[model samples]
Target: MDLLRYVAFTDDPSGGNPAGVVLDAEHLDEPTMQATAAEVGFSETAFVVPRGGGRLDVRYFSPLAEVPFCGHATIATAVAHAHRHGVGELLLNTLAGEIAVSTSASPDGTVGATLVSVPPRTEPLADGDLAELLAALRWSAADLDPELPPRVAYAGAWHPVVAAATRARLAELDYDYDALATLMQRHGWTTVDLVHRESPTLFHARNPFPPGGVVEDPATGAAAAALGGYLRELGLAPAVLTVHQGYDLGRPSTITVTIPQAPGTGIAVTGTAVPYES
Candidate 1:
């Protein structure tokens, strides 16, 4: 099987989050997919099988296990398909649900993909859960942004959305990885969305993805979608928003989200992908 590597959310290969894409995995079993993901060593790898009628069945596997959905991997797969089949709209059936993705070629010869996530939802974080999460991160209640509050949000996957009051608080990411991993495992959380608001339409984020065997994700499309949902549900939605991520680790990525007026609708996450030599 040929594994195609791509970095999503940036035009430069050295900038975005890298993901492995298997364009065709019709004959591959679950074990093979899991093993391949581990070997690839990216946070997640997408296995795609053509289902005809411009539809593809996609499965995402992390280094440690399978995940319901992955934004960066989906972006990579869509861009790869566009390269082979031409830029257009495609329907993807993921473990989470159906996602619609559209790809286009830019004037600069770059391919970009925008994925509409499954209908997202959010639930208030229980006090006990919040306490545990805070303890794991070594953060006190004072560190949180009261404006954003805290909640568990879901688009394709679950993420605890925590907003830091200051950029400095968000940047100091020392945390108990194992403890947080265990907590996330129990709650079925894919990542901890640690964010700081730079402006009404601009945000900076860091994602702790111990569940995927990655200490941190350079750019997280799934979490970005969840954040959009969280904002809309809380009546803080913006017409358009930009998420800036990966600067701390040097692989900067940019994700743009567009939220519709209708409630419980899919959140659109757009990003560019570049081929990686790996």
Candidate 2:
């Protein structure tokens, strides 16, 4: 079981969110995968099992349990694959849906990966659920950004979309981890997408992943992709947007999202990943 450490959304290994990626995970069982993720101690570790015809079955595991999908880990896995096999397209069959990823090189020859997420949908949060979520996070209705109302958004996994009125409110992530985790577990939510709009195209984000045994995810590609869909569905932003995250955590990373304002089409999330060596 070789665990490769990589950081997605940044060219530098020290930046972005660190993830454990197993390029070939054929023999590992469920318990073994969980244990490996726990030992790796990252937010999420991706296991890729090769199927026939250039298709791969991908599973994501955190220290605590299996997550339906994870963006950073996907980016790390694709970057790792690009290093071994030349840049190209790969079909990933995830628990959530089928994801199509393409790898390319920048002008400076930096490998970057862009994943097209499954079609997204958003629904207004139920009254009871929103109350419970606010109580768990210790945030009142006043703290939320009025422009981006609370909604349950889904790209691959379900995430309760909450927007902060200010960047400081988003940065000061003081939440009851256990309480939030219990609430999320009950509601089947992957993460609380806490975001603040710096501008129409530029935004800041923080994701609380207590269920995954992580305080905050530095760079969250999943949430970014979901946000793009959320915005498109709500007519919030233009088709293209850039999200900056992990700055408050001191691991600044960037995720670019492209939405074509089309219905029943997946949004694209683009980022770069680099290998983290000892």
Candidate 3:
């Protein structure tokens, strides 16, 4: 299989989360795709099979397993496709659902992609689930932001949205890997979206993806989209939000989220990605 490496969410190749893109994965089997993703050693790798008509069949894989949907990989794949097919609208059929993406080249020569997720949903976090999550995160109920209550949010994949009262609390992220992984697997959660609100429009985020066999994900697009749904469902956020992630890990990624006025509408996430030197 031919593979291309790119970093999503940042214009600099060294920044953002790195992903492996297989543009021609039509013949690769599930095990081959999984093993290739493991060999790539990135948070996730995207495999694309062209179905023509500006549509593609997309799949995402982490080092350990396959996920229903992945935000960064989607962005990476869209931009990579744009590079070959010319920037425009593209449709992706994923396990989660169909997603629409648009790609373009900025005036400064940076390539960017915007993806609209499937209709989002938010659910109240079960009391027992909250307790277990806090325990695994080494946090207590007091550490939480009262204004933004806990919830399970989904835009393509499921994530537990927990808000921290202070940036200090959000920064110190030492968690029990095994415990969190077990809980995440049982609950079918892709990541835990730990966030700290800096303002009405700006927030800081960290995602622990133990189930993916990664200690942490520098930038998580799916989590960001889920967060948009969570905020909208709770009526806690404005229509536009900016998420800053991977700062602590030194990758520093920026994700722009736009929530429409319509209920249950798809969230749009925008970011730039850069290809790595071969």
Looking at model 1, residue 18 earns an lDDT score of: 96
Model 1 spans > 4 angstroms off? none
Off by over 4 Å in 3: none
Candidate 2 structure lDDT: 0.89
lDDT to native, each model = 0.95, 0.89, 0.94
Candidate 3: tens digits of C-alpha lDDT, residues 1-278: 78999999999877898899999999999999999999999999999999999999999999999999999999999988888888999999999999999999999978999999999999989999999999999999999999999999999999999999999999999999999999999999999999999999999999999999999999999999999988888887688999999999989899999998688999999999989643
Tens digits of per-residue lDDT for model 1 on 201-274?
99999999999899999999999999999999888989899999999888999999999969989999999998
User: Who is ahead in TM-score, 1 or 2?
Assistant: 1
- Model 3 local distance difference test score: 0.94
12, model 1: CA deviation in Å?
0.8
Best candidate per lDDT, number? 1
RMSD of each: 0.8, 1.2, 1.0
- Give lDDT: candidate 3, residue 10: 95
| Candidate 2 vs candidate 3, TM-score winner | 3
Residue 139 C-alpha lDDT in model 2: 86
- Ranked by TM-score from best down, the candidates are 1, 3, 2
| Cα-based TM-score, every candidate | 0.99, 0.97, 0.98
Using lDDT as the yardstick, the better of models 2 and 3 is: 3
Q: Could you give the candidate ranking by lDDT, starting with the highest?
A: 1, 3, 2
